[model samples]
Target: MPELEVSYKTTSKQFLGRVTTSKESADFIRGLFNEGEIELQEQFIVLYLNQANKIIGYYKHSKGSINATVADIRIVLGTALKCLATSIVVSHNHPSGNLHPSAADKVLTENLKQSAALMNIKLLDHVIITKDGQTSFADEGLLGIKTYDQHTAFVQKVTEALEQKTKHNKLSLEKLAQTFGITDKTEVKELTELAIIKTARILAHSAGNVKERFDKIVELYHAQVNLSHRTSQSILLQQYSTPAPIGYLAGIFCEVDKLKEKGGYAFEPSAGNGLLTIAGEPERFYVNELDNFRNQNLKTQGFANVWNRDATQAFFDVQGNFNAVITNPPFGTAEKKVMYDTYSIKPLEHVMALRALDCMAQDGKAAIIIGGHTNWDDKGRIQAGKNRIFFNYLYSRYHVCDVININGAKLYSRQGTSFDVRLILINGRKLKPEGAASLFNPLKDVEVKTFDELFNRVMDAMDAVTNNTFMKPTNTLEREAIELQKLFTTTELISRFDNPPPQEGLGEALNPPYQPACESSVVLNTQVPDSMAFETRTAIQSIKEAVGGDIDNFVRHRLKYPNK
Candidate 1:
């Protein structure tokens, strides 16, 4: 077993002189500092006084630059307690000869008072000393501490009285402040303005017309004793935040003609305030929004078939088919795998595309906007691998009608960050299961410098689709042509065509143009020339490393395509 001991001691000395009033306190504080010390820089000092108002001990808490010095409330309270002080007086000097108490001075005095009270110590005064004179927060009655609840209630009562009277017959703000026991002019104005703004926002939601709402809000403000309101006002304000520019919405709707008919059932799976769905104005529309506030907004706007639920869950259980589905789902969210077990589609954009397909009519079409990672490169060429698996799957199932690259400026709100935007247009008709999908560069012919230009090109394309004059899907044929053209344009092909080998030692004189199938150790056949043997061996070594050595099989490939 171990033994423990505790000890206590008091080494502080006693002090004697009483400081009852603000002037006597200020004079004692001023007398402590010499004229030379006061002229150097700003300094904060605390004077610990006893129950009889006698000075016990004093501490210079901080020394700062010519303009200001920092004083920590903790240091002040600790020093008072250490010195056995019952009351304390704090002071600081301003080198600029100004004796007015700053806004920070008033706040600091209130905080010190509150903290000292907690320790069972009284705060006598806070004085600002200057070259000219001194000012005391105690003398001005600014040191009286009031709780936040008391101030807020007073302001609300005054605001209610003002709302009940006409503009010409209203009570003066100064008189109202005096009646409410609030002395500071700045606080009176600030609290009044805050109360007025609170009323305006609540009434803004109740009525539509400007003058009518203002009049009605005044009537309600006067009749009510208290108003229940949202603690966080920004939540209501952010509901009005614009998600995307109207021009981008217009551009999406420009493809209306591409649908099986001009008008039919439409749906927005991730409807945020129903902006796109409401703007598109399909004959019949449905919406799904995860946010409860936005769902209520959609309902207030006369959208009845709105489902406030997670998109993934709601989409999984969706009942009816949509003729046209348009959506811009949340990006950068983790998507869980459901319904399809074979495919490992993880990105939210890719998952939304697959889910959108599930709820579409057999002949339905869709326009989707995806994030930057799928569409852009530094050199501005289509890198084509980010969403290659998803795109290939689409081509295998449905016809990918068009692809467009929307400039960042046209896709987001004015205050939003710039990002790369990609749109994919799909035709609901299914393709044969056996063949691969074709890829084409539709953006090559379209000018997307401005929203208008982009919208016009989409409209023209939709017109062609509706008139049955759309371009045929020759994507596979175009890709084959491009490959053959590249082969003919190679430098090695040109060199081989211009020069021929001697027929006498045809096999021995000619170096194999292609790589070998294997690179296992073996002696070279002496019949082959030295110059051609070095190049042939090197090519064979590379091929064997890549495909595992099959020498005879590699030779047959070279013979099959002699020029290549």
Candidate 2:
């Protein structure tokens, strides 16, 4: 048997002109297409570029009827690999001449971008060319793909600056205590706050954008204040903060971006240092942390509202008010009693989940991270007994979307311990009365063992839930009663305890991090070239010559238009 030889062939050995702007790339691509065929059909093309953005070659991928064409990502990427191209730009023509991209276009571009990222190849742009003009995904900010190199460089710079600031602050605090013999805890706290404020200002000066600045500062503050110095109470409470990446994934599972765009309210019942709250990024953020220091930390992070109360009884005042909720509640048995309808005592995770569901507004969404043992047994089977009852109650009352078991070993390696953890994504719609009888678990049948698997599973779940609409159940009265009773117990618990007011002035310097800044100046010019019309005319002339100078008949015989 003979093996087939693989090789890339090109008519032109030298490269085309370098492409810096979207307009230049679009013009170059337009020339590659036959002007008559472009209006008559839909076609996908890929331009392979070197590190200097010089086009090595172009491949005509697929051609279809007037309405649509397939952009096979595998073929496109394989050709780039064969050419050793560092980046690629994909283009497709829309015969309809509509400048606005369709939803399908966005999905295809996202899929291609994600796949290209895995091979260390950059997707520079997805250009939509029309007879009249073109649209650039990168120029319109529709790509939604971050430049990893720039992001990593910025983060490294901030991390180094933070380390120096931490060391300097420690030295200054030590000198103050030694020289003045001022050891009162309150005074020492005030001094430490001032040091943090100065450090924040210094970091803020070097940030490239407002979003990056806020995210880094919140992350820095969480790392500096929460994990660097742990209190005895935090340990006793079993406070294991959710990693930032995990928190961000939970937010995606809940569709927090869409909720935030609608100016929705978000609540975190047990917001340790407010990492999950930061991930939620809703227009209005509310947080409750039982630990005094952490509760104060939330206030200092400038949340819209801060409460120092037990997770099970935290948000009684604002029941059914939150539009989004992302929480990582305590995992172990509760030292304090957590009572809900019919269940006097439950696992801390169970009660906390109920508390969050109780506070969600109608049609709201949530992502809750809980212990795997709460639902899965030692052998990974669905646990029976009390866990079944809890899940049954949830299924009867709410829309349980999915249960994804995240690999705990990789998720918590930074903490030097590993355990099973699962995330539950749910919506706030009440189920019909018949739903009570359907006591089935929504957990994934197979275990998720790697971080990539968990991420892909979460993204798939997010897309599925977002695209399909879950009907709002009509049994409002019964659902309302159940929620009211859940809150009523919390209200009773709250009445017996009085929480001190959160400290102020700790967030004064933190204001700059959250303030809006100027837009990034890296946008490529997308204006169509002035010579496009003339070039189109020239291309048409050439096409007419090839088709025996009968342009009208050529178009009439070949062109097909879609029904609007």
Candidate 3:
């Protein structure tokens, strides 16, 4: 009998296409399905791609009943290996017209992702398709992974540039001081400060306006840092910066922009790069950030005063001076407990809130984002422990106006974690004796499961409140909040996959075409091509030896430097 021969062939003379976004991937996959079968039966399809994300081919893995399908991981990996594909996008169509992934869908996706990693293949995204629309696991952050993209790349580049400039300026300043034989520490410090200011101005001008520059710098801090190191640091410090939408919402409640227009003073305790202050657009603002890097960033933004002291100390000299205080303070307990008179407020968020209140003028308004659990449980009842003491203290002393519960999953998806947060809008003025007595009786918290639910509860609370000049009119505030919600939701949903609008003169380089270093060619008679055979063999050997049989490291190495 003749030896059996296996060969790979392609019908197309050119590449099918390259997919960069979840929407594009969905569209390409949808076009491959049989229109008649798509609505009648569930089908699992996988698209194999080269390192550049250019589609190599697609395989219909399995087909089953209307609502479910069985997908074999071996078959999927086998096809990818045959195609020499580096990445895969798995998608399935739902006959029920629901874009949401079922429990089984999520399980299958996780399994496939892990399996692909073992084989040195990237599972880029898992999409659910319906006639109406598509849902991407990557876009929704369901994959529980972070992939490097243009935004991260840009931030990394900016960080490198900044570091180089800083080093050069420092060396030059030292050389100048040596040449002049100058030993005055104050003079050297002043000169260094001037250099930093000049460098910041240059970066600010190149990046764009205050908001744009602030965002870029924040991204630089998050992206350029090592993930594990940063995670450890963050946990120790309880440092989670406010998302832009949350910052804007806090600003709206605090009326930051209006205060800015009136030349009112604002204070932000535990300001992370002054994002909250930027949202308020306050002309006169004082900020305190414990992190040295973040404090330097605040200075770069040209804030009136950027203090690097413990915020619990309450800016003693400037106490009772601020018109507005807007902040998202560090959550969890402080390393050293803070005392409120004889009472101990162990929760760092509460300490910061109390400090903010102290820093505010008698009529100052504040919107503080704190851990939601501090006020109520999931069932809307007050929680036990230190929370009760903190709430009682707050209600008995300050004018507690309204609390808006924000869904952390929707807000912090990019950060790859979720927790509930509450934005408490407060007045610095002490509550009237009768009002304080009534509020201190018992706390009635509203149970909220969704954004809409929490929004309605907030609106109702606003309606019940009387004679509060800090809050805008009910109709106006409602309309503005609704608009902001719409904008925020739209921005979050589409931001993951959408390409930034092209800038003038940058042209195609802004969104470069996918180009693989080694062109994929047909394999015949189980023979590997000489061009890729050496690299492939070496990569496999390196994976087996150096990485202890971990394919993920090898695959990432190849993808990072494709030409090698």
| lDDT at residue 563 of model 3 (Cα atoms) | 35
Clashes of each: 5, 0, 0
In candidate 2, what are the lDDT values of residues 1-564, reduced to their tens digit?
999887988998988876656777788888988858878888999998875467888999999899989888889998988898878889988888887889999999999999998997889888999876999897677888532222222223333545564443434444444444444443333334433433444444344643454455545554443222334554455566765556666665665645556787888888766656544442268878776655644543445677777777646688888888888887765544465555444677787888888888878888888876444443222466656666667766778666776676766533323667878878666644234312123334446776556667777666667776333333333333333324434444224222323334423221111111112224343322221322333465567679776655555566752311
Q: Model 2: clashing residue pairs? A: none
Q: Summarize candidate 1's per-residue lDDT along 278-342 as a digit string, tens digits.
A: 33432256777776545533442333266766666536565438777777766544556553434
As for candidate 1, its clashing pairs are 17-54, 18-53, 516-539, 516-540, 518-549
Model 3: lDDT equals 0.61
lDDT over C-alpha atoms for residue 244 of model 2: 53
Q: How many backbone clashes does candidate 2 have?
A: 0
TM-scores, all candidates, are 0.42, 0.44, 0.41
The residue pairs in collision within model 3 are: none
Which parts of model 3 are misplaced by more than 4 Å? 1-229, 374-381, 431-564
Best-matching candidate per TM-score: 2
Candidate 1: which stretches are off by over 4 Å? 1-263, 314-320, 338-342, 373-386, 410-415, 434-447, 467-564
* Model 3 Cα lDDT, one tens digit per residue, 74-182: 8898889888887899999999998889999999999999999999888989989987689989777788874322222223333344456433333444455444443
Please give the range of 10 consecutive residues that has the lowest summed lDDT in model 3.
Answer: 433-442
